[model samples]
Target chain A: MRLLINKIFLALSILSAGVGLAFLAWILITLFMKGLSSFHFSLFLNDLIEGGLRNLIVGQMILAGLASLIGIPLGMTAGIYIQEYGQGRYAALIRDLSDIMMSAPSIVIGAFVYAIVVVPMGGTSGFAGAIALAIMMIPVVINTTDSMLSLVPRELREAGIALGASKYKVIIDIVIKAAKVGIMTGILLAFARIIGETAPLLFTSETSNYFSLNLGESFPSLTVSIYDLANEPEESSRDLAWAASFILTVLVLIINLTGRFITRNKK
Target chain B: MEKIFQKLSLSSATLVFVLLIGIFITLYSAAKPAIDEFGLHFIINPDWNKEIVVETPSLRADTVANDAEDDAIADEDDMILDEDDDEMLLDDEDDTVTKTIYGGLVPIVGTLLTTIIALTFALPIAMGIAVFLAEIAPKNISYVVGIAIELLAAIPSIIFGMWGLYYFAPIVADLVGGYQVSLLTAGLVLGVMILPFMAAITRDSMNTTPAVLKESAYALGATKFEVIKDIIFPYSKVGIIGSIILALGRALGETMAVAFLIGSIFVLPKAINDPTISIPVAMANNFGEASGLGESALFYLALILFIISFAVISLAKFYFLKKAK
Candidate 1:
């Protein structure tokens, strides 16, 4: 009787897990059915009003890339500081502030940028959007860097110091190399997050029906365009929205998979 | 050279302070025009349109100027509107804006209502799955089930939104015999969305209960149910509560999926079947049409959302810190 009950319970676990997976599968299938109908090379080459997501695609890549570039180094440095040299009251305050920033609403980050960068700069420029995305990126990188640095064997650091290495040299060579894969994972995950963000770009980076390469100009990202198009009354716009959503999702998933791959490869 | 490098590092650390200052300065300046126009009452009062008409004189001056000096007077008058007007406007607009801002309350309430309902439904099922995996599930099946549950966390929110829109809404409406885009349907869909987070967290928490606790309970001739109730549940209480709070945080901030599923309406709902707007949904709904004061109003709404998420996340952080200590 006990054995039979155990078997039933095991089946229940599998059943529950199956239910969750099935829901995810259903969601993906629906996106493909709606979005794939519009899939074409032209969708990647033309501007939105010109019947493609070309500008949006480029804008998203550039802005998110810039955000990652700026955010990763600062966050890693802060993380290293907290994990290595930090102690007492100041470190505690920095840690708490980073936590608060991490879970602050995405839209608030947008508002903060709108107030700070976009408003002061005189318009909703891509640079303002990048700043907002960078804000989102910072907390993720900080957490990952801290964790990765913490995981480095203490003996490794001591050994570096014993070999006549300065504290700076020890961090750059021994500690950073040891935590490289984990730090990379954090960066990829941060990229995945900023890529799908729609709110911040709405206020700080949105462009209307025009294509330009200027960083100071407002440029619509794929996520913002998808959001705008989805709300339109036109069927064509809605279809395009689905396609944009699909593209964004696929891009993020690819980043997530790459992060997973990097972590797994290191292991 | 070493001193130069240290100075460089210190300056870079100073950049974090610079970034924070930059953020504050930008918010203050961007909000300046509206802030100057509204004064302190801007946040409290909701009458966003304080219309000050600027009459540019047509070069053909025969058109009557109410006063020849009224143009400059109007500019000065715009500045000189009495604190009394501000006070009265505050009373009237405060209620209205509060309604619109709180107009989100229906959605907020609906979201909370649905989340509770989802948790009510999901908790027992999640607990059952956790118990099964920890104590009863065969080792091979357990690994597969665990991997599958973890994968659910990886699924993007937009996909969930699309699925809810195309598939779940209609079926839920048919089965539940109510409005197609009611709270119940949103709740059910969100239940599915949150189940993975709850299940995985709960399972880990349950598994972490020292083996000796459960073993001792079982040796005392406790049945499986008794063991779960007396030993496992008590042991994992803090973690279980923390997991639930984390899940609630996710549900609160969830934008795309809930936006698609919950029919976005600005008014408060008197019934569960009524379409409602959540804070995130309200932000999305207004983003397309927002201009001028309408745009600032949306920013205000976003600020409120930031407050809600900030509060919840801080709570979670506090719990984690306590546990860590």
Candidate 2:
């Protein structure tokens, strides 16, 4: 009876696992089919008014890059602090607070930004949007960086300290260097997380009809455009949304795969 | 200078603490106007209207007043019904809908329903995949599957929303033989979106289980299933629960994708296929046009979401920090 039950359990586990994979496959297949069916070479070059997605693609890159520039440094510092100096009463509190901020809804962060930056500025801007996305980015970076730094063995830190190196030098030279690949992976993952963020951009960037690199003005972003285009009644608009989705999905896929490569410890 | 550098790091970490307090301050300050006008009833009421008069929550207990209001409401409802029977159509123009409005019951109910439905669908699949990759599969295969599963997490919530709106919702609608974009569709998309986080947490917890425990179980003539059930789950209860809370936070605050697939119906539903709009989605879709109380009310929704997710995230952080220690 135990053998029979075990066999049944194994079958059930495998079957459920297949369902997970199948669902993932189905989503990708449908996305590819719809996106590619409407996709043409011109889809990459034509403007939104003329029915294309190139501008939004460019906009997403600019937004992600800016957000990363702001978030990566702040996040890494917090990460380093938590691992190195965040040991007592205050640091523990900071650690908890960071986790709360990390889990707070992206939309709430957007609304918060809307009040502080957008409302005060009297209009939405790409810079405000970048800050919102950066807020979302920081917690992820801190978490990943904290864990990655921890993975740098204790002996390495001890060795550096024994050599009369300052704690700062020990971290910069030994710890960070040791955890380079993991830190890189964390940064990449943080970038990937914010790139597809729509809620933060909604109220802050406020969606421009045209491509604008000016941080003072409203900007086009892939997720926001996808939101706008998906809701449209036109076939061309829906097709544009599909292509954008495909691109975003593929981009994230590549980054995540690269992250996997970097974090893969052969030893 | 090095001391300054160290101080900078400490202050930077402290900045996140300041940020958490800042979120509540900003939201509450923005929402204070609407909250003052509606009192606590702002949350307890379901109607959200522009031109409608609102009944105070105190009057809810007065049967005589309620009967008078109900009679007046019925007469007004009959008048509106004579003009149009469709609830959604009646909702389009603000002046035409009934009075006693500016309630959040619908969005609150919708948010909970969609999140619960999402958790229901995601938990099983997440656990199964986690079990496979963590315990059952060969090392190489597990590594590949693990990476692929993490890739699923990397896909932005917006893409899921777009796909759900353009592709997934239609198929589900077809399967149910109902209209596209409803509560069920939104929930399913959320389910798929949250699977990675929950599975990743469970897998981590599973990874920490001592090999010796499983081996001893096996030596005692226990089956693989018996070992997992008896040893793995019992040991990882906190982590498993922590992941569930994390997934709940993600689902509760999920905006773009849920907004797209959920049909933006403000009315609470009695059926799975009924249209609904969650709190985050409410803010997403309407904040652009919102003014005065309408705008502050959206902030109120954000405030509620913030508080709830704050508690959930705290529990999750507790578990996660324990693991780190």
Candidate 3:
């Protein structure tokens, strides 16, 4: 009876793992079938207004890129302060709060941005969307930077100090250099996470039909557009949503894999 | 130079604190109008976007007497009773006041029910997968499978939403005999979305158990199940619970996945498969055209969601996971 129970437990565990793999396979296969059916080279070349996705693709890059610009610097510096400068209660407090912020509802962050940025500006803009994404990215970046910086040996920082380097210089020159690859990978993962975000951009940037470079205006967002298109009554719109979803999944997966690959290669 | 750089980094760290407080204040003030209008009753009141015609004695003496103390509260109570029969309150001598009231009970209940359903569905599969990865599988197989699971987590949630709607929901509806988009389908899809995430974290926690403990259990004539149940599970229980709560927090705020499947409507779900709206779905769908008190009500919902998630995550992180760390 005991042996039977053990065998049954093992079988059940394997079956659960199989269930997880099956869902992934099912979703990917469906994505390929539906997405590829609608996919065309022209879909990339033309704007959404022209029955294509050029505008949204470019626009999403700009939003995520701008978010990285804002988030990486602020988050890294905050992380540096947490891991290096501070020693006791305050550092721990910041670390704890940053972790909490990492899990705060993304839509609340969007609402917060909408109230502060969009409301004050009197309209939704690319800037509001980027700011929302940046808020989401900051905590993730801080997490990676804090953990990555912690992994750097004390001996390395001591060596720089022994060589007469100032505290900030040692941190900037040596400590940062040592943790560069890890931080970069973390940032890449952070970018991938935010690039696929839909909720935060729903009302902030509020996706435009036409491509506009102006940050002051409503910007095109691929994820938000997918939500909108999928909900539309038209079958063509639903097909377009699938195609957009496929591109988005491919992009996010590639970035995610590249981040993991970089760390693996380094190890 | 050192001082300047230190100040710069210190201020940046301070920004995180500032942002958290800012989000609270911003949501509170934005939600202020609805909070003031509905008081605490908004949470319990199920009526959303409900307009009622209230009649009061038009005599100046009667109106003046009613306005003496607690005017808004008294008037709202009258409005609630007259909601079903607006015409009954219509009289030539009586002044009719039209008021639109919004309440959060439907979406809040909907959110909690769906989350409960999701947790119920995901908890077992996640535990099983974690056990497989941590103990049963060979290291190489575990490594590849772990990566595959993480990749599932990396897929954008909107894809989950769309796929759930188009492909998954129909099969679910066929089995359960309900609307394609429903609380059940949404919760199940959400379960699928969070499964890999929960499994990966649970696996990490399980892997934290020392080899010696498991080896000792095995040496003592323990089977694989015995070793896991006695050694690994007891050792990693807190971490596993923490992971589950963390997944709970994630599911609570999940928008895109639930939005596609939840059939965005403000009715109370009478059955497991009934179509209803969650707080996030309500905000996602209505934020565009909503104005005045309607918009404020959405912010009110946002504020509640933020606070609930904030408390839930803090409990998981500061209480449960802290010991694990």
Candidate 4:
């Protein structure tokens, strides 16, 4: 009876793993097939009426760039504070609260930004959307940076302090330098993540039809455009969504795979 | 200057705490009016008229501006104004209804039910994969499989929605009683989306289960399966459970995939194929034009979802801490 149960368990494990991999392949293949066929060269051009993707791509860049600008610095600094200087009940509180924030439903972050920024301003804007994504990015960066900084050898910090260097100097010069690659990987993953987010921008950015540099107005993003277009009744609009999804999926996969490679190489 | 740097670092950490408090403040203050008006009935009462899904744009932007012409269609789903109770204020001059009575029971129920279904599909399969990667597979195969799992996770929720809605839903529609977009479809896609999360943490904990413990079991004449069941699984059980709870949190808050695949309607599903919408999906679909009571009610729903996520995550954290100790 025991031998039979063991054999059955082994068969079930292999079968489930196979099912998981098969689903992965199906999702990717379907995405690539429809996405590639829907693709058009005009997508990269900046014509206003035909609904080109130039504005969408540029909008994603501006939004993600601004978000990273705010999120990376705050996240890295907070991470350093937690890993290097966090102590007692205070540090423990920060650590736990941040973990909760990380797990908080991301759509709620959209609601929070909408309540704070969009309602007061009378409408959605690129600034509000960027701030929402930055909020999502911070917890990820903090988690990664804190873990990476903790990985840096304690002897390095001790040696620097013993050599009469200030704590800040030792941290900046030795600790951050050692953990630079890991920190970059974290930022990359965070970037890849917020770039594909649709919910936060659904009401916050509110979607734009044309390319506009005004941070005061609603903006176009690849993901939001995909959301709007996918819901439309028109075939052309649906194709546009597919093309955008293809690009977004390919970009995210590349970033993630690169991060994985870097980590594996290091270990 | 160096001392100032220290101060800056400490203050930055303090900023994270302030941000958390600020989210709570803004969310609570925004939801307060609705909470005061509706009380516990907001979650339990299932009589949602137009405020449940709000499909038409007559509610868009300024409902007051469009009320005259839009009132005809708006009344199709809403009878609160038509009922004309003495409780209603009855804007005699403008003829505009001031409030849309809101209850989120359907979406809230849908969110929990779908997440439960997703976990049911995801947990055992995810555990099976973790066992294979941790103990059964060779190192090279495990490494390749592991990276593939990470890539599976990297595909965003929206893309999963796209694939599931267009490709997978049609194929399974007959199986799900002819409704293309149903709770089962959403749960299946969500199970796929969260598989990596459950498996990754489980695999890591299993990998770290102190090889000597497994070796001793083997040396005592145990089979491979017996060793895994007796030593490795028992050791990593807490971490495995923690990962499942964390994945449950992810499944609960899932928006785009559930939105696209669940037929984008707020209904108490009576069958496997009945159309439904989760809280996050309902919030996403209706948030754009929501105003007055509708806006605050939406905020209240978001707060409820946030609280659920908070409690689930904290539970997982406790499990993790205990496991670490």
DockQ of each: 0.32, 0.71, 0.88, 0.71
Interface RMSD of each: 3.8, 1.3, 0.7, 1.1
Q: Compare the candidates by DockQ and give the number of the best one.
A: 3
Candidate 1 vs candidate 2, DockQ winner: 2
Residue B63 accuracy (lDDT) in model 4: 55
Error in Å for residue A107 of model 4: 0.4
Residue lDDT tens for model 3, B1-325: 9999999999999999999999999888889999988888889988899866543444345565575454465446645565555454544324656568889999999999999999998988999899999999999999999998998899999999999999999999999898999999999999999999999999999999999888888999999999999888899999999999999999999999999999989999999989999999999999989999999999999999999999999999998899887
Stretches of candidate 2 exceeding 4 Å from the true structure: A265-267, B54-101, B319-325
Clashes of each: 3, 3, 0, 0
Docking verdict class for candidate 1: acceptable
Write out fnat for all predictions, comma-separated.
Answer: 0.31, 0.78, 0.83, 0.73
List candidate 3 segments past 4 Å from native: B55-72, B75-83, B89-94
After superposing candidate 4 on the true structure, give the runs of residues whose Cα lies further than 4 Å from its correct spot: A47-49, B50-99
lDDT of 4 by residue, B1-325 (tens): 7878877777877878988898888989999988876677689756554422223234456655675555345445444444644333333323333445678898898898889888898888898899999988899999999888877787878988988888888888866565888888888888888988888878887887898998898899887789888898788878877888888998999898888888877678998777888889988988887778788988899989988898899998875735654
Q: Write the per-residue lDDT of candidate 4 for residues A88-149, one digit (tens) a residue.
A: 88877887787888878889999999999998999999999999999988888888999899
Tens digit per residue, CA lDDT, model 1, A240-267: 8888877877787788878888998987
The global C-alpha lDDT for each of the candidates, from Candidate 1 onward, is 0.70, 0.82, 0.92, 0.83
Candidate 4 local accuracy as lDDT?
0.83
